[model samples]
Target: MFTNEQVDRFHKDGFLVVPHFLSQATSQRLLKISHEYLEQIDLSNHPLTRFTTSDKDHLGDEYFLNSSDNISFFFEPDAFADVDGHHKLVKPKERAINKFGHGLHLCDANFAAVTSGNADVSEIAKGLGFQRPRALQSMVLCKQPEIGGAVPPHQDSVFLYTDPLSAIGFWIPLEDATRENGCLSFAPGSHHDHPVTKRFVRRFDKETGEQLDGTEFISLENREQIEKGFAKEENQKWVSVECKAGDLVLIHGSVLHKSEVNSSNKSRFAYAFHLIEDTAVYDKLNWLQSSVKSILY
Candidate 1:
Protein backbone atom coordinates (compact mmCIF):
# COMPACT_ATOMS: atom_id res chain seq x y z
CA MET A 1 0.00 0.00 0.00
CA PHE A 2 0.90 3.73 0.10
CA THR A 3 2.82 4.94 3.15
CA ASN A 4 2.40 8.24 5.00
CA GLU A 5 5.96 9.32 4.33
CA GLN A 6 5.61 8.44 0.70
CA VAL A 7 2.43 10.47 0.47
CA ASP A 8 4.06 13.39 2.28
CA ARG A 9 7.01 13.34 -0.05
CA PHE A 10 4.75 13.09 -3.06
CA HIS A 11 2.83 16.17 -1.98
CA LYS A 12 5.99 18.11 -1.37
CA ASP A 13 7.97 16.91 -4.34
CA GLY A 14 5.25 16.26 -6.90
CA PHE A 15 6.51 12.68 -7.24
CA LEU A 16 7.05 9.52 -5.15
CA VAL A 17 8.60 6.11 -5.66
CA VAL A 18 7.26 2.84 -4.24
CA PRO A 19 10.02 0.29 -3.77
CA HIS A 20 8.04 -2.50 -5.44
CA PHE A 21 5.18 -1.92 -7.86
CA LEU A 22 6.04 -4.30 -10.63
CA SER A 23 7.40 -7.78 -10.44
CA GLN A 24 10.46 -8.72 -12.46
CA ALA A 25 8.29 -10.68 -14.84
CA THR A 26 6.09 -7.70 -15.62
CA SER A 27 8.97 -5.39 -16.44
CA GLN A 28 10.47 -8.01 -18.68
CA ARG A 29 7.21 -8.46 -20.53
CA LEU A 30 7.00 -4.76 -21.39
CA LEU A 31 10.59 -4.62 -22.47
CA LYS A 32 10.03 -7.56 -24.72
CA ILE A 33 7.19 -5.73 -26.34
CA SER A 34 9.42 -2.72 -26.95
CA HIS A 35 12.10 -4.76 -28.69
CA GLU A 36 9.47 -6.06 -31.09
CA TYR A 37 7.93 -2.63 -31.61
CA LEU A 38 11.26 -1.04 -32.37
CA GLU A 39 11.77 -3.33 -35.32
CA GLN A 40 9.05 -1.83 -37.54
CA ILE A 41 9.70 1.90 -37.36
CA ASP A 42 12.35 4.54 -37.82
CA LEU A 43 12.66 5.48 -34.14
CA SER A 44 16.18 4.95 -32.89
CA ASN A 45 17.86 8.13 -34.11
CA HIS A 46 15.82 10.76 -32.29
CA PRO A 47 17.46 11.61 -29.00
CA LEU A 48 14.32 13.36 -27.76
CA THR A 49 11.98 12.70 -30.62
CA ARG A 50 8.30 11.87 -30.53
CA PHE A 51 9.10 8.81 -32.65
CA THR A 52 11.95 7.17 -30.82
CA THR A 53 15.65 7.50 -30.25
CA SER A 54 16.85 10.32 -27.94
CA ASP A 55 17.01 13.15 -30.43
CA LYS A 56 15.70 16.13 -28.41
CA ASP A 57 15.30 18.56 -31.26
CA HIS A 58 13.00 16.51 -33.44
CA LEU A 59 9.93 18.34 -32.15
CA GLY A 60 8.07 17.35 -35.30
CA ASP A 61 8.49 13.73 -34.30
CA GLU A 62 5.93 14.29 -31.52
CA TYR A 63 3.03 13.72 -33.89
CA PHE A 64 4.34 10.33 -34.92
CA LEU A 65 1.69 8.30 -33.07
CA ASN A 66 1.22 5.32 -35.30
CA SER A 67 2.40 2.52 -33.13
CA SER A 68 0.56 -0.69 -32.23
CA ASP A 69 1.79 -0.02 -28.73
CA ASN A 70 -0.20 3.20 -28.33
CA ILE A 71 -3.45 1.84 -29.70
CA SER A 72 -3.21 -1.19 -27.47
CA PHE A 73 -2.39 0.91 -24.40
CA PHE A 74 -5.26 3.39 -24.67
CA PHE A 75 -8.01 0.83 -25.00
CA GLU A 76 -6.68 -2.18 -23.14
CA PRO A 77 -9.35 -3.88 -21.05
CA ASP A 78 -7.53 -3.46 -17.76
CA ALA A 79 -7.51 0.26 -18.42
CA PHE A 80 -11.22 0.48 -17.62
CA ALA A 81 -10.78 -0.82 -14.09
CA ASP A 82 -8.82 1.72 -12.05
CA VAL A 83 -9.44 4.03 -9.06
CA ASP A 84 -8.31 7.19 -10.83
CA GLY A 85 -9.31 5.43 -14.08
CA HIS A 86 -7.54 4.69 -17.34
CA HIS A 87 -6.03 7.32 -19.62
CA LYS A 88 -5.24 7.36 -23.34
CA LEU A 89 -1.88 7.36 -25.11
CA VAL A 90 -1.45 10.23 -27.54
CA LYS A 91 1.84 11.25 -29.17
CA PRO A 92 3.07 14.67 -28.14
CA LYS A 93 4.89 17.51 -29.84
CA GLU A 94 8.32 18.19 -28.44
CA ARG A 95 8.95 21.76 -27.32
CA ALA A 96 10.86 23.92 -29.74
CA ILE A 97 14.62 23.82 -29.53
CA ASN A 98 14.86 26.81 -31.95
CA LYS A 99 12.69 29.78 -33.14
CA PHE A 100 10.39 28.96 -36.08
CA GLY A 101 8.13 26.39 -34.41
CA HIS A 102 5.92 28.57 -32.19
CA GLY A 103 2.56 26.78 -32.07
CA LEU A 104 1.86 24.24 -29.36
CA HIS A 105 1.56 20.80 -30.89
CA LEU A 106 -1.76 19.19 -29.88
CA CYS A 107 -0.07 16.02 -28.73
CA ASP A 108 1.94 16.13 -25.53
CA ALA A 109 5.56 15.07 -25.18
CA ASN A 110 4.97 12.61 -22.32
CA PHE A 111 8.17 10.91 -23.31
CA ALA A 112 5.97 8.77 -25.50
CA ALA A 113 9.23 7.71 -27.00
CA VAL A 114 10.07 5.38 -24.14
CA THR A 115 6.71 4.01 -22.89
CA SER A 116 6.30 0.59 -24.43
CA GLY A 117 2.53 0.76 -24.43
CA ASN A 118 -0.63 0.78 -22.29
CA ALA A 119 -0.23 -1.45 -19.28
CA ASP A 120 -2.17 -4.46 -18.13
CA VAL A 121 -4.25 -2.13 -15.95
CA SER A 122 -5.82 -4.71 -13.63
CA GLU A 123 -2.48 -6.32 -12.96
CA ILE A 124 -0.60 -3.02 -12.77
CA ALA A 125 -3.13 -1.39 -10.42
CA LYS A 126 -3.09 -4.40 -8.17
CA GLY A 127 0.67 -4.38 -8.07
CA LEU A 128 0.69 -0.68 -7.13
CA GLY A 129 -1.56 -1.56 -4.12
CA PHE A 130 -4.74 0.03 -5.39
CA GLN A 131 -7.41 -2.38 -4.16
CA ARG A 132 -10.48 -1.41 -6.15
CA PRO A 133 -8.83 -1.55 -9.58
CA ARG A 134 -7.52 1.52 -11.41
CA ALA A 135 -6.40 2.67 -14.81
CA LEU A 136 -3.49 4.94 -15.64
CA GLN A 137 -1.35 6.16 -18.50
CA SER A 138 2.03 4.61 -17.85
CA MET A 139 5.24 4.53 -19.92
CA VAL A 140 8.31 2.38 -19.52
CA LEU A 141 11.63 4.22 -19.78
CA CYS A 142 14.56 2.10 -21.02
CA LYS A 143 17.98 3.69 -20.76
CA GLN A 144 21.39 2.36 -21.60
CA PRO A 145 24.12 4.02 -19.52
CA GLU A 146 26.03 5.54 -22.38
CA ILE A 147 27.14 9.17 -22.31
CA GLY A 148 24.45 11.88 -22.93
CA GLY A 149 21.62 9.67 -21.70
CA ALA A 150 20.40 12.35 -19.33
CA VAL A 151 16.96 13.91 -19.77
CA PRO A 152 16.79 17.68 -19.55
CA PRO A 153 15.55 19.52 -16.44
CA HIS A 154 12.07 20.43 -17.64
CA GLN A 155 8.90 19.91 -15.55
CA ASP A 156 6.20 17.36 -16.51
CA SER A 157 3.14 19.63 -16.26
CA VAL A 158 4.88 21.85 -18.75
CA PHE A 159 5.03 18.82 -21.06
CA LEU A 160 1.39 17.97 -21.57
CA TYR A 161 -1.63 17.83 -23.84
CA THR A 162 -3.58 19.97 -21.45
CA ASP A 163 -3.15 21.97 -18.22
CA PRO A 164 -4.41 19.35 -15.81
CA LEU A 165 -2.95 19.73 -12.31
CA SER A 166 -3.20 16.36 -10.55
CA ALA A 167 -1.63 13.05 -11.46
CA ILE A 168 -0.04 10.28 -9.39
CA GLY A 169 2.72 8.54 -11.37
CA PHE A 170 3.94 4.98 -11.01
CA TRP A 171 7.66 5.12 -11.91
CA ILE A 172 8.85 1.54 -12.26
CA PRO A 173 12.44 0.59 -12.75
CA LEU A 174 12.96 -2.59 -14.75
CA GLU A 175 16.58 -2.74 -13.73
CA ASP A 176 18.74 -1.49 -10.89
CA ALA A 177 18.42 2.26 -11.45
CA THR A 178 21.08 4.41 -9.84
CA ARG A 179 21.75 8.14 -9.73
CA GLU A 180 24.79 7.61 -11.89
CA ASN A 181 22.57 6.58 -14.76
CA GLY A 182 19.37 8.61 -15.21
CA CYS A 183 16.95 8.72 -12.29
CA LEU A 184 14.30 11.33 -11.60
CA SER A 185 14.58 14.64 -9.67
CA PHE A 186 11.79 16.86 -8.38
CA ALA A 187 10.95 20.26 -6.92
CA PRO A 188 8.93 19.64 -3.75
CA GLY A 189 5.52 21.24 -3.12
CA SER A 190 5.53 22.89 -6.52
CA HIS A 191 2.07 21.55 -7.28
CA HIS A 192 0.06 23.47 -4.67
CA ASP A 193 1.13 26.91 -5.85
CA HIS A 194 0.75 28.69 -9.16
CA PRO A 195 2.39 26.82 -12.00
CA VAL A 196 5.96 27.83 -12.70
CA THR A 197 5.74 28.88 -16.33
CA LYS A 198 8.93 29.57 -18.25
CA ARG A 199 9.00 32.14 -21.03
CA PHE A 200 11.62 32.40 -23.73
CA VAL A 201 12.24 33.59 -27.28
CA ARG A 202 13.92 31.23 -29.69
CA ARG A 203 17.40 32.41 -30.40
CA PHE A 204 20.45 31.18 -32.27
CA ASP A 205 22.76 28.89 -30.37
CA LYS A 206 25.76 30.84 -29.10
CA GLU A 207 28.31 28.31 -30.27
CA THR A 208 26.54 26.65 -33.21
CA GLY A 209 24.72 29.81 -34.30
CA GLU A 210 21.63 27.71 -35.09
CA GLN A 211 18.40 29.69 -34.78
CA LEU A 212 16.00 28.53 -32.09
CA ASP A 213 12.39 29.36 -32.85
CA GLY A 214 9.45 29.76 -30.47
CA THR A 215 11.47 29.04 -27.37
CA GLU A 216 11.14 30.46 -23.86
CA PHE A 217 12.69 33.88 -23.36
CA ILE A 218 11.87 34.14 -19.63
CA SER A 219 9.87 32.53 -16.86
CA LEU A 220 6.92 33.89 -14.87
CA GLU A 221 7.11 31.26 -12.13
CA ASN A 222 8.77 31.97 -8.76
CA ARG A 223 12.01 32.73 -10.59
CA GLU A 224 13.77 34.40 -7.70
CA GLN A 225 12.59 31.93 -5.06
CA ILE A 226 13.22 28.78 -7.12
CA GLU A 227 16.75 29.99 -7.84
CA LYS A 228 17.46 30.67 -4.13
CA GLY A 229 19.17 27.34 -3.38
CA PHE A 230 16.35 25.83 -1.34
CA ALA A 231 17.58 22.42 -2.47
CA LYS A 232 20.80 22.72 -0.47
CA GLU A 233 18.94 23.92 2.63
CA GLU A 234 16.24 21.20 2.81
CA ASN A 235 17.88 17.82 2.46
CA GLN A 236 14.57 16.00 2.72
CA LYS A 237 12.92 18.62 0.52
CA TRP A 238 14.93 17.37 -2.43
CA VAL A 239 14.75 13.64 -2.99
CA SER A 240 15.54 11.56 -6.06
CA VAL A 241 14.10 8.08 -5.96
CA GLU A 242 16.31 5.22 -7.11
CA CYS A 243 15.22 1.61 -7.44
CA LYS A 244 15.89 -1.92 -8.52
CA ALA A 245 13.82 -3.97 -10.93
CA GLY A 246 10.23 -4.36 -9.66
CA ASP A 247 10.51 -1.10 -7.70
CA LEU A 248 8.04 1.67 -8.54
CA VAL A 249 7.62 5.36 -7.79
CA LEU A 250 4.16 6.95 -7.55
CA ILE A 251 4.36 10.65 -8.24
CA HIS A 252 2.12 13.70 -8.53
CA GLY A 253 1.93 14.57 -12.21
CA SER A 254 2.20 18.24 -11.42
CA VAL A 255 5.53 17.69 -9.74
CA LEU A 256 8.45 19.42 -11.36
CA HIS A 257 10.55 16.44 -12.40
CA LYS A 258 13.25 15.56 -14.91
CA SER A 259 15.27 12.47 -15.91
CA GLU A 260 18.98 12.27 -15.18
CA VAL A 261 21.40 11.45 -17.98
CA ASN A 262 23.18 8.13 -18.09
CA SER A 263 26.81 9.16 -18.28
CA SER A 264 28.36 5.75 -17.79
CA ASN A 265 29.47 3.11 -20.26
CA LYS A 266 27.09 0.51 -18.90
CA SER A 267 23.51 0.05 -20.05
CA ARG A 268 20.66 1.53 -17.96
CA PHE A 269 16.97 1.51 -18.86
CA ALA A 270 13.54 2.04 -17.16
CA TYR A 271 10.00 2.31 -18.48
CA ALA A 272 7.57 4.97 -17.07
CA PHE A 273 3.79 4.97 -17.61
CA HIS A 274 2.03 8.33 -17.30
CA LEU A 275 -1.48 8.39 -15.81
CA ILE A 276 -3.81 11.37 -15.84
CA GLU A 277 -7.44 11.90 -14.80
CA ASP A 278 -9.80 9.69 -16.79
CA THR A 279 -11.82 12.68 -17.92
CA ALA A 280 -9.04 14.90 -19.14
CA VAL A 281 -9.66 16.31 -22.60
CA TYR A 282 -6.95 16.06 -25.24
CA ASP A 283 -7.90 18.75 -27.73
CA LYS A 284 -5.82 18.97 -30.85
CA LEU A 285 -3.76 22.16 -30.80
CA ASN A 286 -3.02 21.51 -34.44
CA TRP A 287 -5.89 23.25 -36.21
CA LEU A 288 -4.33 22.93 -39.62
CA GLN A 289 -4.76 19.19 -39.70
CA SER A 290 -7.21 19.43 -42.56
CA SER A 291 -5.75 22.57 -44.11
CA VAL A 292 -2.30 21.20 -44.79
CA LYS A 293 -3.32 17.70 -45.80
CA SER A 294 -3.21 18.18 -49.58
CA ILE A 295 -0.75 21.02 -49.86
CA LEU A 296 2.31 19.59 -48.14
CA TYR A 297 3.88 16.29 -49.18
Candidate 2:
Protein backbone atom coordinates (compact mmCIF):
# COMPACT_ATOMS: atom_id res chain seq x y z
CA MET A 1 0.00 0.00 0.00
CA PHE A 2 1.09 3.60 -0.61
CA THR A 3 1.16 6.48 1.80
CA ASN A 4 -0.78 9.72 1.40
CA GLU A 5 2.37 11.52 0.26
CA GLN A 6 3.18 8.85 -2.30
CA VAL A 7 -0.34 9.01 -3.70
CA ASP A 8 -0.07 12.80 -3.92
CA ARG A 9 3.24 12.48 -5.73
CA PHE A 10 1.72 10.09 -8.26
CA HIS A 11 -1.18 12.43 -8.90
CA LYS A 12 1.13 15.42 -9.27
CA ASP A 13 3.87 13.84 -11.37
CA GLY A 14 1.86 11.22 -13.30
CA PHE A 15 4.36 8.54 -12.23
CA LEU A 16 5.85 7.05 -9.09
CA VAL A 17 8.82 4.76 -8.50
CA VAL A 18 8.83 2.34 -5.57
CA PRO A 19 12.15 0.75 -4.76
CA HIS A 20 12.23 -3.06 -4.32
CA PHE A 21 8.51 -3.49 -4.73
CA LEU A 22 9.07 -7.21 -5.38
CA SER A 23 11.40 -9.48 -3.48
CA GLN A 24 14.61 -10.75 -5.08
CA ALA A 25 13.22 -14.28 -5.04
CA THR A 26 10.06 -13.22 -6.86
CA SER A 27 12.03 -11.23 -9.41
CA GLN A 28 14.39 -14.11 -10.09
CA ARG A 29 11.48 -16.51 -10.38
CA LEU A 30 9.83 -14.36 -13.01
CA LEU A 31 13.08 -14.02 -14.89
CA LYS A 32 13.62 -17.77 -14.82
CA ILE A 33 10.14 -18.37 -16.18
CA SER A 34 10.73 -15.84 -18.94
CA HIS A 35 13.92 -17.63 -19.91
CA GLU A 36 12.16 -20.96 -19.92
CA TYR A 37 9.49 -19.66 -22.26
CA LEU A 38 12.08 -18.12 -24.53
CA GLU A 39 14.15 -21.32 -24.66
CA GLN A 40 11.12 -23.31 -25.78
CA ILE A 41 10.35 -21.07 -28.77
CA ASP A 42 10.31 -22.87 -32.11
CA LEU A 43 11.23 -20.28 -34.72
CA SER A 44 11.25 -22.73 -37.65
CA ASN A 45 7.61 -22.03 -38.50
CA HIS A 46 7.50 -18.51 -37.09
CA PRO A 47 6.72 -15.46 -39.19
CA LEU A 48 9.49 -13.53 -37.40
CA THR A 49 7.37 -10.56 -36.33
CA ARG A 50 9.52 -7.65 -35.20
CA PHE A 51 7.94 -5.40 -32.60
CA THR A 52 8.38 -1.72 -33.35
CA THR A 53 6.34 1.43 -32.67
CA SER A 54 8.38 3.69 -34.93
CA ASP A 55 7.26 2.08 -38.16
CA LYS A 56 3.56 2.52 -38.87
CA ASP A 57 3.74 0.32 -41.94
CA HIS A 58 5.11 -2.63 -39.92
CA LEU A 59 2.91 -2.31 -36.84
CA GLY A 60 0.85 -5.48 -36.39
CA ASP A 61 0.45 -8.72 -38.31
CA GLU A 62 -1.66 -11.85 -37.81
CA TYR A 63 0.81 -13.25 -35.26
CA PHE A 64 0.75 -10.04 -33.23
CA LEU A 65 -2.96 -9.34 -33.59
CA ASN A 66 -4.08 -12.81 -32.53
CA SER A 67 -1.93 -12.86 -29.36
CA SER A 68 -4.48 -11.28 -27.02
CA ASP A 69 -5.45 -14.48 -25.22
CA ASN A 70 -2.42 -16.61 -26.11
CA ILE A 71 1.29 -16.40 -25.33
CA SER A 72 3.23 -15.15 -28.36
CA PHE A 73 6.80 -14.26 -29.30
CA PHE A 74 8.13 -11.27 -31.18
CA PHE A 75 11.65 -10.62 -32.44
CA GLU A 76 13.81 -7.52 -32.39
CA PRO A 77 14.26 -5.73 -35.68
CA ASP A 78 18.01 -6.27 -35.63
CA ALA A 79 17.81 -9.86 -34.39
CA PHE A 80 18.22 -11.24 -37.89
CA ALA A 81 20.97 -11.09 -40.48
CA ASP A 82 20.49 -11.45 -44.22
CA VAL A 83 22.04 -14.77 -45.24
CA ASP A 84 22.04 -15.35 -48.98
CA GLY A 85 18.41 -14.54 -49.85
CA HIS A 86 16.91 -15.59 -46.52
CA HIS A 87 16.85 -13.93 -43.12
CA LYS A 88 18.66 -15.80 -40.37
CA LEU A 89 18.75 -15.12 -36.67
CA VAL A 90 21.95 -13.38 -35.62
CA LYS A 91 21.95 -15.00 -32.19
CA PRO A 92 20.20 -17.85 -30.43
CA LYS A 93 16.41 -17.70 -30.55
CA GLU A 94 16.17 -17.06 -26.83
CA ARG A 95 18.36 -13.97 -27.08
CA ALA A 96 16.86 -12.79 -30.35
CA ILE A 97 13.28 -12.20 -29.14
CA ASN A 98 12.18 -8.68 -28.31
CA LYS A 99 9.25 -9.80 -26.16
CA PHE A 100 6.54 -12.41 -25.49
CA GLY A 101 3.36 -10.86 -24.47
CA HIS A 102 -0.29 -9.77 -24.20
CA GLY A 103 -1.61 -12.69 -22.19
CA LEU A 104 0.98 -13.98 -19.72
CA HIS A 105 -1.07 -13.25 -16.61
CA LEU A 106 -4.16 -15.09 -17.82
CA CYS A 107 -2.46 -18.14 -19.35
CA ASP A 108 0.65 -18.70 -17.20
CA ALA A 109 0.19 -19.77 -13.59
CA ASN A 110 3.47 -18.30 -12.32
CA PHE A 111 2.76 -14.92 -13.85
CA ALA A 112 -0.84 -15.05 -12.72
CA ALA A 113 0.34 -15.60 -9.13
CA VAL A 114 2.20 -12.30 -9.15
CA THR A 115 -0.21 -10.33 -11.30
CA SER A 116 -3.78 -11.48 -10.75
CA GLY A 117 -5.44 -11.39 -7.35
CA ASN A 118 -2.21 -10.36 -5.58
CA ALA A 119 -2.77 -8.58 -2.29
CA ASP A 120 -0.12 -5.92 -2.87
CA VAL A 121 -1.33 -5.09 -6.39
CA SER A 122 -4.93 -5.03 -5.21
CA GLU A 123 -4.04 -2.69 -2.37
CA ILE A 124 -2.20 -0.37 -4.73
CA ALA A 125 -5.12 -0.35 -7.12
CA LYS A 126 -7.55 0.52 -4.35
CA GLY A 127 -5.27 3.28 -3.13
CA LEU A 128 -5.21 4.68 -6.64
CA GLY A 129 -9.03 4.93 -6.56
CA PHE A 130 -9.77 1.91 -8.69
CA GLN A 131 -13.02 0.27 -7.61
CA ARG A 132 -12.85 -2.65 -10.04
CA PRO A 133 -9.44 -2.90 -11.64
CA ARG A 134 -9.18 -5.36 -14.49
CA ALA A 135 -5.79 -6.70 -15.44
CA LEU A 136 -5.67 -6.70 -19.24
CA GLN A 137 -2.39 -7.21 -21.10
CA SER A 138 1.01 -8.36 -19.82
CA MET A 139 4.44 -8.65 -21.41
CA VAL A 140 8.15 -9.23 -20.74
CA LEU A 141 10.11 -6.62 -22.63
CA CYS A 142 13.64 -7.79 -23.41
CA LYS A 143 15.88 -4.90 -24.24
CA GLN A 144 18.58 -7.09 -25.71
CA PRO A 145 22.22 -6.05 -25.62
CA GLU A 146 23.39 -3.80 -28.46
CA ILE A 147 20.28 -4.43 -30.57
CA GLY A 148 17.48 -3.20 -28.36
CA GLY A 149 15.27 -0.75 -30.24
CA ALA A 150 14.10 2.63 -29.05
CA VAL A 151 10.42 3.05 -28.23
CA PRO A 152 8.84 6.20 -29.61
CA PRO A 153 7.21 8.62 -27.21
CA HIS A 154 3.55 7.74 -26.79
CA GLN A 155 0.73 7.26 -24.29
CA ASP A 156 -0.67 3.91 -23.17
CA SER A 157 -4.29 4.95 -23.60
CA VAL A 158 -3.66 5.23 -27.32
CA PHE A 159 -3.40 1.47 -27.52
CA LEU A 160 -5.56 0.30 -24.57
CA TYR A 161 -8.39 2.74 -24.78
CA THR A 162 -11.35 3.09 -22.43
CA ASP A 163 -14.23 5.57 -22.34
CA PRO A 164 -12.82 7.75 -19.57
CA LEU A 165 -9.19 6.67 -20.11
CA SER A 166 -8.47 4.77 -16.91
CA ALA A 167 -5.57 2.62 -18.13
CA ILE A 168 -2.49 2.42 -15.89
CA GLY A 169 0.81 0.64 -16.53
CA PHE A 170 2.73 -1.30 -13.87
CA TRP A 171 6.36 -1.74 -14.98
CA ILE A 172 8.74 -3.94 -12.97
CA PRO A 173 12.34 -4.31 -13.91
CA LEU A 174 13.67 -7.88 -13.79
CA GLU A 175 17.26 -6.62 -14.13
CA ASP A 176 19.12 -3.39 -13.53
CA ALA A 177 17.87 -0.62 -15.80
CA THR A 178 20.43 2.01 -16.61
CA ARG A 179 20.99 4.88 -19.02
CA GLU A 180 23.13 2.65 -21.19
CA ASN A 181 20.59 -0.16 -21.22
CA GLY A 182 17.44 1.55 -22.49
CA CYS A 183 15.74 2.54 -19.27
CA LEU A 184 12.40 4.36 -19.47
CA SER A 185 12.24 8.15 -19.72
CA PHE A 186 9.30 10.44 -19.04
CA ALA A 187 8.18 14.00 -19.47
CA PRO A 188 7.11 14.87 -15.97
CA GLY A 189 3.46 15.90 -15.56
CA SER A 190 2.89 15.69 -19.30
CA HIS A 191 -0.30 13.82 -18.66
CA HIS A 192 -1.97 17.04 -17.54
CA ASP A 193 -1.15 18.83 -20.77
CA HIS A 194 -1.14 15.99 -23.27
CA PRO A 195 -4.65 14.73 -23.89
CA VAL A 196 -5.56 11.48 -25.57
CA THR A 197 -6.03 12.65 -29.16
CA LYS A 198 -5.09 9.53 -31.05
CA ARG A 199 -6.05 5.89 -30.88
CA PHE A 200 -4.62 2.67 -32.24
CA VAL A 201 -7.60 0.82 -33.66
CA ARG A 202 -8.31 -2.35 -35.57
CA ARG A 203 -9.20 -1.73 -39.18
CA PHE A 204 -12.05 -3.38 -41.04
CA ASP A 205 -13.09 -3.96 -44.62
CA LYS A 206 -15.55 -1.33 -45.78
CA GLU A 207 -17.55 -3.53 -48.15
CA THR A 208 -17.88 -6.63 -46.01
CA GLY A 209 -17.51 -4.86 -42.62
CA GLU A 210 -15.09 -7.57 -41.56
CA GLN A 211 -12.11 -6.91 -39.36
CA LEU A 212 -8.86 -6.48 -41.21
CA ASP A 213 -5.59 -8.25 -40.50
CA GLY A 214 -3.53 -5.32 -39.15
CA THR A 215 -3.92 -2.25 -36.96
CA GLU A 216 -3.57 1.47 -37.53
CA PHE A 217 -3.31 4.66 -35.54
CA ILE A 218 -6.22 7.04 -36.07
CA SER A 219 -6.41 10.64 -34.94
CA LEU A 220 -9.23 11.73 -32.71
CA GLU A 221 -8.41 15.30 -33.68
CA ASN A 222 -7.88 16.88 -37.09
CA ARG A 223 -4.45 17.18 -38.68
CA GLU A 224 -3.83 20.78 -37.67
CA GLN A 225 -4.84 20.15 -34.08
CA ILE A 226 -2.67 17.05 -33.84
CA GLU A 227 0.29 18.99 -35.29
CA LYS A 228 -0.12 21.72 -32.71
CA GLY A 229 -0.25 19.14 -29.92
CA PHE A 230 2.97 17.62 -31.20
CA ALA A 231 4.58 21.05 -31.27
CA LYS A 232 3.66 21.62 -27.61
CA GLU A 233 5.29 18.33 -26.59
CA GLU A 234 8.51 19.16 -28.44
CA ASN A 235 9.35 21.80 -25.81
CA GLN A 236 8.90 19.52 -22.80
CA LYS A 237 12.01 18.11 -21.11
CA TRP A 238 12.40 14.38 -20.56
CA VAL A 239 14.01 12.81 -17.50
CA SER A 240 15.54 9.34 -17.53
CA VAL A 241 14.22 6.84 -14.98
CA GLU A 242 16.76 4.22 -13.97
CA CYS A 243 16.04 1.44 -11.49
CA LYS A 244 17.44 -1.74 -9.96
CA ALA A 245 15.88 -5.19 -10.20
CA GLY A 246 12.47 -5.57 -8.49
CA ASP A 247 11.77 -1.83 -8.58
CA LEU A 248 8.20 -0.87 -9.48
CA VAL A 249 7.39 2.11 -11.70
CA LEU A 250 3.75 3.13 -11.97
CA ILE A 251 2.99 5.00 -15.17
CA HIS A 252 -0.09 7.07 -15.89
CA GLY A 253 -1.98 6.06 -18.99
CA SER A 254 -1.80 9.53 -20.54
CA VAL A 255 1.82 10.25 -19.68
CA LEU A 256 4.29 10.70 -22.53
CA HIS A 257 7.05 8.17 -22.07
CA LYS A 258 9.72 6.40 -24.10
CA SER A 259 13.00 4.45 -23.92
CA GLU A 260 16.20 4.75 -25.91
CA VAL A 261 18.00 2.00 -27.76
CA ASN A 262 20.28 -0.20 -25.64
CA SER A 263 23.86 0.31 -26.76
CA SER A 264 25.47 -1.46 -23.82
CA ASN A 265 26.62 -5.03 -23.32
CA LYS A 266 24.08 -5.56 -20.56
CA SER A 267 20.46 -6.47 -21.16
CA ARG A 268 17.48 -4.74 -19.58
CA PHE A 269 14.53 -7.03 -19.02
CA ALA A 270 11.24 -5.89 -17.53
CA TYR A 271 7.71 -7.16 -16.85
CA ALA A 272 4.80 -4.82 -17.58
CA PHE A 273 1.01 -5.01 -17.51
CA HIS A 274 -1.95 -2.67 -17.95
CA LEU A 275 -5.02 -2.23 -15.80
CA ILE A 276 -8.26 -0.46 -16.59
CA GLU A 277 -11.30 0.35 -14.52
CA ASP A 278 -14.02 -2.15 -15.25
CA THR A 279 -16.55 0.66 -14.90
CA ALA A 280 -15.28 2.23 -18.07
CA VAL A 281 -16.47 0.95 -21.41
CA TYR A 282 -13.71 -0.81 -23.29
CA ASP A 283 -13.63 0.17 -26.91
CA LYS A 284 -14.49 -2.67 -29.26
CA LEU A 285 -12.20 -1.35 -32.00
CA ASN A 286 -9.03 -1.53 -29.92
CA TRP A 287 -6.29 -3.78 -31.23
CA LEU A 288 -6.31 -6.07 -28.16
CA GLN A 289 -9.32 -8.11 -27.12
CA SER A 290 -9.61 -11.07 -24.77
CA SER A 291 -12.15 -13.81 -24.13
CA VAL A 292 -10.52 -15.04 -20.89
CA LYS A 293 -12.19 -13.72 -17.76
CA SER A 294 -10.21 -10.75 -16.40
CA ILE A 295 -8.69 -11.16 -12.98
CA LEU A 296 -10.13 -8.81 -10.36
CA TYR A 297 -8.86 -8.92 -6.84
Model 2 misplacement above 4 A: 206-208, 221-231
Tens-place lDDT per residue, model 1, 88-150, is 222221111111111111122323322222344333433434433212233435454343244
How much is 54 displaced in model 2, in angstroms?
1.5
Encode model 2's per-residue lDDT on 241-272: one tens digit a residue.
99999999999999999999999999899999
Model 1 residue 113 lDDT score:
24
- The lDDT per prediction is 0.42, 0.88
Best by lDDT: 2
- For TM-score, the strongest prediction is 2
